[model samples]
Target: MTNSTRSGKRDRLAGAAVRVLHEQGVEKTTLADIARAADVPVGNVYYYFKTKDQLIEAAIAAHGHHLESVIATLERLPTPQERLKALVHSWVEQRDLAAKYGCPTGTLASELDKRDDGLDRAIAKVMGELLGWMERQFAAMGREDARELAVALMAAYQGISLLTNTFRDPALMEMEGHRLERWIDSLA
Candidate 1:
């Protein structure tokens, strides 16, 4: 196969890895599950990623790229407050999925954090990138304690996500999204 075709398959595998990992949790997700999700044969998964850790690494990279793209879009907003509100709104749009399966990154990171294999560190990098972006936004809003504001923003998001998932209530995300928007505006 051509290199592009090979990459297409690899990308598909990685995307499926993220979805499967999100839906089923990393520990319970098998190569077969990813293959089934990707609509490819099990051997095809090994051709791209030899082990579960490799797949997890690919998922982390995929999440990182996706997060960067999102931040890029958010950066286009007129102000830091608007950007931060847009971020919360976008996540709130995924309320149904969060209700069913939880915030994809947060859930995966929480689960992987308990392991000794260092995959946790890989996922943590994605979270760090997000934290850095939020910190910059807070700084743009003229907050001297940008890091603390970033942590607070993330805490509210993560806390609401947990409650939304735990209660299986999408409305909770809506309410918190509004509250977060107001909080961000107040800070601005």
Candidate 2:
């Protein structure tokens, strides 16, 4: 097969891994399941990912990249504060999506030390980039404690998101988001 075909097959497997992880949770998903879902042979799946952890790493990386793209597009709005609010609002609107699929990074991070070292590092790298981006934006707005504030805000956002997902209640999400927004505004 051509390189393009091979690459497409690999991507399809990775996407399937994401779906499996979302549907079955990381614990229940297996290489055979992913192969079946991708319609690829199990050995072929192994060709792309030496281990199940590698596949999970790819899925998490894909999710992180998708998130970064979404945030990057929204971050280009008028002012730093506007961009920040828009970021938070955009994330809140997508709470339903996470409710359906689970938070990929949070799922991995919660099991952080249990994950393969490489996978853990990759997830941490993505998170550091995101938090660092938030810090830079906040600092530009004259918030000297931007790093601490960014960490706090993201912690609140993630924590609230997990809570809302657990309860399956939009009201909880809205309450948490509104409180976070007010706190951010006070900081500004």
Candidate 3:
């Protein structure tokens, strides 16, 4: 296969793994499930990943890349405050999926935290990247307590995501998104 073809298959596997992991959680999602989801042969999964842990790592990396894309998109807005609000709105736009499967990154982190294998650290790094982006936005807005505000913002998102998933209610996420936007606007 050409390098582009190989890379495409790898990306397909990683994307399928993310979806399977989100839908079934890490414990229940198998490599075969991912392979089937990717429409690749079961053995082909081993071509890209030696173990389920490696695949999970790939999924986490994909989420990190996704977070970076989100940050890049937000950077296009004219003002820091608009960027922050846009960030919240972007997440809120995932309310339906959040209601169905919970926040993708948050749910993966929570599930991986249950294990003793230290995958939680990887999750923390991914979460930190998002928090750092939010912090920079707040700092650009002249907030002295940018880190604290960022933490609060993420806390609110995680909290609402948990509630939205538990209740299977998308409106809760929308409501919280509006509330967060207002809170962010109130920030200095």
The alpha-carbon RMSD values of the candidates against the true structure, listed in the order shown, are 0.7, 2.2, 0.8
Local distance difference test, each candidate = 0.92, 0.78, 0.94
**Candidate 2 lDDT over residue span 1-188, tens digit each:** 89999999888888888778776777888999999999999988877899988898778777787778977796778777777777787767867766665455666666654755666677778778878888987897899899998999788878876877787775666777778778777877
Quote model 2's TM-score.
0.86
For 1-188, candidate 3 gives per-residue lDDT tens digits of: 99999999999999999999999999999999999999999998899899999999999989988888988888999999999999899989999999999999999999999999888899889999999988998999999999999999999999999999999999999999999999988885
How do the candidates rank by lDDT, highest first?
3, 1, 2
Candidate 1, poorest ten consecutive residues by summed lDDT = 37-46
Error of 2 at 60 (Å): 2.8
| Cα lDDT for residue 35, candidate 1 | 92
Backbone clash pairs for candidate 3 read: none
The candidate, 1 or 2, that scores higher on lDDT is 1
